[model samples]
Target: MRKLETRTIVVASHNAGKITEIADLIAPFGFAAKSAAELAFDEPDETGTTFEENAAIKALASAKASGLPALSDDSGLMIDALNGAPGVYTANWAERDDGTRDFAMAMEKVQKALQEQGAEKPQERTARFVSVLCLAWPDGHTEFFRGEVEGTIAWPPRGTAGFGYDPIFQPEGHKRTFGEMTAHEKHGWKPGETQALSHRARAFKQFVETCLEG
Candidate 1:
């Protein structure tokens, strides 16, 4: 098993929320995680068609630019009723005329589209959030991990704790939406807690087991 030699790792993303989540996950491993924005690394264009490809692209770009190991993730909500639409274009779906992505608007668009498809019942609105994480070394070696959480879309959106589609996503076996859960509840501060059920959390767990833990 290979272990990281550096005390710092770059999180190749401009999203503050993503960086925070990743940093928290990796904090216990005795590594300092810095965001690309904090390091002044230019954001790379994600031209890949799949989550894994995009994650690798970003991770590699940051690693090459910063001369440090970097981590990146690409995630989206995949609605079964929509035939997995807006998969790679999840953020794009929320782009406004001003070119800013509004997740609330995006969630509304998803609901409207489902209604158009005659998916009136909660059972028909089945969906899952998929996340892919890639860790790229400055030497160009990379490792990938993926995670998913099944859920149903809730109407009128609920909660305000989480970002993006959290308000609308009610994880299986949970009565409350993800947006309702605190950071600790969503990510599981304690062991043996199945309640920590975010897609990003799941992916990070895999990375820890496969790459960080020997």
Candidate 2:
């Protein structure tokens, strides 16, 4: 078992939602998490071809830049109908004309593409959100964890709570979309909650158990 020696760690991401969730998860371990944005850390190019590689790139970049332990994640939706397209390029698919990412537009594009391919049924829309977490130390030691949540894509995107493709993703055994769940509901203490069901949460759980709790 390995343990992190730092009290203050950097979350190597600019996404506020990601930063917030990660901060919450590590709080119990007596870690004071800070976002790379807060530290004005320059965003590094994510040139990796896989989620784990990308996560490691970001984590190492931040760790080296800040001289502190850094945690980073690469997560995205992978649609079977699309042959796992938009996997690493998920965010790229959501880029709008205004240079901002919009999940609504991204979802619309997905539906349009699927429709073009004659995929209309829920079963045909099978997909999953995959997350890979990487923890890196300034000295170059690194760890990785991966997790995924299977679901089907729902048309007419539902919910308003979660960010990204949450509105259109319906987890298996659940009628409601992730976007419909409140923060507390999404990350609640109970089993089957988002904290338990979410890919990021699952990956972070492994991180906690293997690194923080050791």
Candidate 3:
């Protein structure tokens, strides 16, 4: 079926960084994008089992709530050695609250696990960041796209540009890590650049392409 035109877009997330990224992505296309926070939308329970499910749930909820086309993204770090663990629980792998261990704690667990396995060296620890984005429309329509960044884990974390696992993730073919690179440097997408290589960027690019085609 032919997709209808979407004039206004809603991103169902309150994360400033995410909102900024999405806005930057949509700006080039001349689309007006708004965040859930701006609309004062309540955070929906992410009861889905996987990234895709969670993304769809959020997108649908937002679309229904705002009555406008909505988009959502669910992403996490999947470690090969951990059996893809932290895949869906990337946000809450460690602490719960006062003892809450955020991404930093998650990294600590990774390090400890590696030490236990006697493979703490950079060469021994490999990981990838994966992101899945879902788009939902008011008329019960939806679509999905995924992106990933493969890289080795770095100890002690480096830089501070990107958030979450960025400091610890050193992308493939690059000597510096994501957190190490400036935002401008990281967003320098050359022509023919594939968004599938970047976890969030890939998904957003795919969504944009799909929208244009639709």
lDDT scores of the candidates, listed in order: 0.87, 0.86, 0.77
Per-residue lDDT tens digits for candidate 2, residues 31-63, read: 777889999999999999999999999999999
TM-score of 2: 0.93
Q: List the residue pairs that clash in candidate 3.
A: 195-202
How would you encode candidate 3's per-residue C-alpha lDDT over 1-214 as one tens digit per residue? 3343866889888767777766766676667888999999998888887899989888888899999989888988887777787788887775557854577787788778767777776667788888888889877688888888788888888997877777888888888888898765555442356533457776776666676654
Who is ahead in lDDT, 2 or 3?
A: 2
Task: Rank the models by TM-score, top first.
Answer: 1, 2, 3
Off by over 4 Å in 2: 188-195
Model 3, runs deviating above 4 Å: 1-4, 98-101, 188-197
TM-score of each prediction: 0.94, 0.93, 0.88
Instruction: Tell me the number of clashing residue pairs for each predicted model.
Output: 0, 0, 1
